[model samples]
Target: MTILAIGAAGIAAVLLAVWLKGVRAEYAVYLVMAAEILFMLSAAGRLEVILDAMERMRGYIRVDSAYLGTLLKMIGITYVAEFASGICRDAGYGALGNQIQILGKLSVLGVSMPVFLALFETLERFMK
Candidate 1:
């Protein structure tokens, strides 16, 4: 979906949620979650294109496939964590949201450990 369309939909959802908050507060949270799911679904289509572009770049750069795969996993973890955390915060669980974010950071760090090790190895070789 185009940015304009997405923006319009987001604004509409927010307005509706604000109105629903007055009538049925719980339903407003549900509505917001539904809107977030729809938005994520729409963005999923574009994610394929991004992945394809990254693959082509990897081929041109001759980088190890494992590194590229790790990068993708890190990116995925970051986005998913942010999405989940946002939902939690919206549902009035700010602490849960913060924890989700921290977990995401740790996950990303864990996933990138191999890359960090490889870099250190390369640097050590140069120093030798």
Candidate 2:
């Protein structure tokens, strides 16, 4: 599993970082960041595979593509927000991390607005 591989690598790197702390702390930090980035890339690769499979199903289904696209956008915002916040936190920028989370919330709300509008419009038409 990718998570297992990452966990093993993380353990080893943590040990190495501990050993390097007294000699070269900056290099240790860089090593840790590199590992984090590698894991992130692996996750993204897996997510892409899933998304591609879903895209393939589009031809067989009569789905609302716009809603699907918006849902995907919301998913992206969630992940990107988490990623940005993690980076900020790791870099010792607490305020920046908070801001990133706020931005993510706003992004989700923005992406969902069209769905909300459609729902309300449908209700209005039914009432009439």
Candidate 3:
């Protein structure tokens, strides 16, 4: 769909949710699900742009593939965790959302640890 169509659809969904809130409010859950589906569909279309940019930049940078891969993994994990947490919050599970955020932070640290250790190891060798 074009940007205008997507925006119109989102606005209509939000209005429907608002109306549903005053009636059978629980049914509004479907609105949230639909919105997320639309967002994910649009994101799927843009994924190639991100990968293409990454690939184009690879020729100009001398960074190790391991570090680049780890960076991408961390970014992907962060986005996924945030999206999941938002859904949890929408479902009234604030505690679960918080837990998801904490796990995401830990996961990002875990992913970057190897690169950190490698950097320090290289520094140690250089100093000796």
lDDT of 3 by residue, 63-114 (tens): 7877778878998899888888888987789899999999999999999999
List model 1 lDDT by residue over 52-89, tens digit each.
99889987898998988999999899989999999999
**Model 3 residue pairs with clashes:** none
How many clashes does the backbone of model 2 have?
Answer: 0
Regions of model 3 farther than 4 Å from truth: 1-11, 125-128
Cα miss at 76, model 2 (Å)?
1.5
Ranking of candidates on TM-score, top first = 1, 3, 2
Q: Where does model 2 exceed 4 Å of error?
A: 56-61, 123-128
lDDT of 2 by residue, 1-128 (tens): 46788899989987887787789987777777777787778778888786886687787896678977887899889988988887777666889999999999999999999988988998999999
Best by TM-score: 1
For model 1 the TM-score comes to: 0.97
Please report, in order, the local distance difference test score of every candidate based on alpha carbons.
0.94, 0.84, 0.85
- Comparing 1 with 2 on lDDT, the higher-scoring candidate is 1
Candidate 1 versus truth, CA RMSD in Å, comes to 0.8
Q: Pick by lDDT: which candidate is best?
A: 1
